[model samples]
Target: MTVPGYRNVPAQEWDPAAPADPAEAEEFLRLCYTEVSRLGPVEPRLAVVRAQIAATGTYVHTTDELVWGARVAWRNASRCIGRLYWRSLTVLDRRRVHTADEIFRLLVRHLQVAGGGSAIRPVISIFAPARPGRPYARVWNEQLIRYAGYRTEEGVVGDPRYVPFTDAMRAMGWPGRGGPFDVLPIVVEVPGESPRLFELPEKAVVEVPIAHPELGWFERLGLRWHAVPAISNMRLRIGGVDYPLAPFNGWYMGTEIGARNLADPDRYNLLPVVAHGLGLDTSHEATLWRDRALVELNRAVLWSFHRAGMKISDHHTESERFLAHMRNEEKAGRPVPADWTWIVPPMSGGATPVFHRYYHEADQRPNFYLDSEAAALARGAGVRPALAAAPLAA
Candidate 1:
């Protein structure tokens, strides 16, 4: 699981049923309790935590610990350059939520709270952790907000990137309206039950209609995007406890929507279309048609979000804030692990300060990671029996 240029980075185990490493688990619990004590009066709770660990090989976190763990996880998220405001994240402690229907309802509430009229706030709704014997609840969506992709006689309809998910949804008896902007229903998998799809109500979603400040023609494109990107599938490992249903969010970075989602060839791939609309000579790459179109597209995204009164950060300001974060971490004697490929802005990579530097390749604990099992389920694969077993709490 080592990425290129990163030395000594080990891939995290993704299997939910894999036995926990006792030594590593013990170290993680020690760090958790130490952090909790530093944040508040947890001396009494420490005894309970230790006893729980002794009996179960894992410990329960107080509400304060959960909040701290979630926030620190964000700070330790090497792939996210937007961690400058990690302290601002809001944690919705939903660890008590168990059923798929309740999970869907809370997800709706998460969208409502985070998407708060484009004043977009960072939030994470943490569900139950996988105990030693019990399988925890899991959501199958990459993000809470995504459009349905449909297969058609003409070609792929809507977003091509979602075809697999869309096909999977169809197999689950979800027949969408088959439109370009159809919102996909969320699929929640509970232990010992069939995975179910829950449709998102229109009132819960906030989308910004994209338009350029000056380019009237851009409005004709009818492009739009959801306000918040609440990643739902990444497993949150805190103090040896794995919460498979923790969905967290942050305000959008303009490049995420403009330079990648709308511009990547496998996605909407609007660069060529936008170039033609702008009358740019697409005859050759030498003309820099793609580059020129990208700028305007990014401009539209920024302008649209601003006009809609939504929270979005331009790459320049975010990069500067990231450097400030790095300095603060260094001053505190904390090592900052970053993935250069992700730390650098998607557009104008070399032009940004982050692009010129090398980052520590080591990964930190209490971080978000992709789970292969969750990914396979999201792709509509048949449920693996092992994944359905309830996690056994020691």
Candidate 2:
């Protein structure tokens, strides 16, 4: 099946029934072993992988190989600006997990492991890889922690992006609280069984109440956001193998919450509210009232997260770290493939150093990918009949 590309990246069509490409496997093994000197030699591992693929169409990754593959995938993520900490990622191998109940329990554990303390760490839980011509399991939520959006007579009560998903959840028997910041349930679907909804415990979700450092009235708005940004739907590809149920997370970049999630018209749309609170003249767009409100909203997000002792990075700091990552990779004689559009921060593009330069754009392997089917599922589009009958591969 054809897996659509993310943004400007080219699409990669993968056939689930097709055998793993021997060349891709060899290249990945060679690279992995060569880079990690302690891994010893690749020849023995290569022979074993070749024989395994010849016998079963795919090869399993050893624990060390799986961990290194996940770390390399983060390093190859073209859109991520926090690649500097790729090596520090915590990879949780959950390949033995299959049932929805077990998956849900582990998912909650994943959240607790990643965001349990004040400092959030990068974590990825890799489940069983898809066998050739077999249906795989996956989570339907775009992120592990997202607020539900209900369409009301007034307007969208929560995040508008999730209204359709919320509707789908309700259809599947989820009794939502109908509040502005109600955390959505985790939808886990196993191979043959129907999708199941598991609500996250209050202890599993770490939230920060947004309040501006200067504006005393800002806390009255009751705006808040989850501390960890755990993306649950993306497929993880490594060494010609696909793991459909791998969910990974990193700490928040302030602009992600401030400039896009909160400021976007379709999202919380909080700029106007903040502007009105600031008493800025909204008479004309030229007055830069929106810009001023956006800055304050971002400030409130950063300050609130900091006050809550939550790990978060400002766009400026992240941009600088990305450049440092590029330099480190270059010194190691490796090309840093990056998408310019995603590398630049959402707000204050010109002010950031990443906006001024060009980056090499390439579809690198051993990277996380968002398949079209997975994206649709995250949007609450229940499994299509055609896709269910003939499942797509990552």
Candidate 3:
């Protein structure tokens, strides 16, 4: 397939019947950002990468496995195509590998000079544990410094919600720390039809108060469409169940969404992102962006892996366990309502945290973080604007 902006790289073919590569197994990382860059400086090298990447089920083991090759491709392609027009230093002057976050820094710079609206979205997936921002972040980040055009030590930017330099962002931007990549937020639709269903599919997930007056009900659920339970004629209802689950049709990003996901919490927080603000007609020019969603989806898939490299992260909420306690409150019929607190899974107990560190090599050099978008935004943009329209808490 011709990926317009980029030359083709070797893509791997998959055998569904065969076992998956151990690296790509269990966890999946999306290297969406580096796809265009993977083509090499030479036409032939670009072809090799194009062929390798074209495969359907290529597995990503480390962040290196995911992005280095792609960055190398871009470095190689620089000889002829957009090189002369570029206003910055050449990547060949610097020889190093880059991490997803670093790539993002460069991507912002690329946009600053290239002036493309949103062609450069990248995602990464990490299958293990690693620190979010330490010196090592440089290892994967070095490659970025080479290709990214401008320079100014500006703290990680590209605020899709608010253009940092824009007077609008400075004058009326929320949280007011303009990012160059700001795009108006879009609001997706939430139907008023019957939403709660039972026997959710394997992908079905829910989030609820850890300490609610009415216990037993979970908070939120993020599952794949395939995971939804087979609804029967009887299962349908207006609302109100012990679990009080809400159905959503969207993404449960594994690890490919990358720095875009990180900048998110820094941008407007995570909840709003999950709500799909890209669709709000009054907010964003989403339709104009609709055509390339596949490319966006591809970026999302790849960026997820980069985000995963930060460190093992999770929602870490005490709300659910407290929900059971809250149930006891109502059972005793206590008039006083319980206050909320940050939820942390008890490590001593049998509870195994989703964000534990992963020792990638024999040296025990910790790499990757098991982060989820739900945790980053803390409650899908919180229980504010989207809540009133959203179903009331059970």
Quantify how close model 2 is to the true structure by its C-alpha RMSD in Å: 3.9
Top lDDT prediction, candidate number: 2
- In terms of TM-score, the best-performing candidate is 2
Q: Give lDDT tens digits, candidate 1, residues 10-82.
A: 4655666554544545555566667556665445555666677677756677787788889989998988998
CA lDDT, every model vs. true structure: 0.83, 0.90, 0.23
The sequence of per-residue lDDT tens digits that candidate 2 reaches over residues 90-126 is 9999999889889989999999999999989999999
Q: How would the candidate models be sorted by lDDT, starting from the highest?
A: 2, 1, 3
Of 1 and 2, the candidate ranking higher by lDDT: 2
lDDT at 256, model 2: 97
Clashes of each: 13, 0, 89
Predict model 1's lDDT versus the native.
0.83
lDDT of 3: 0.23
Candidate 2 ranges beyond 4 A from true positions: 1-10, 383-394
Residue by residue across 1-394, what tens digits does model 3's lDDT show? Answer: 3221123222222122332232322111222223344532334433434344345322222333333332322222211111111122222111132433332233333323221222222222111111112111111111111101111276434433322212221222223223332222211111232111011111112111111122112113121111111100110011000000111111122221222332235542333333343442334556534323323332333333233331112222222323443344357453212111112222211243322322111100011111232122211232233233322111
Ten contiguous residues minimizing lDDT sum, candidate 1: 385-394
RMSD of each: 4.5, 3.9, 26.1
Off by over 4 Å in 3: 1-104, 110-371, 378-394
Candidate 3 minimal-lDDT segment of 10 residues: 235-244
Give the TM-score of each candidate: 0.91, 0.95, 0.17
Pairs that clash in candidate 2? none
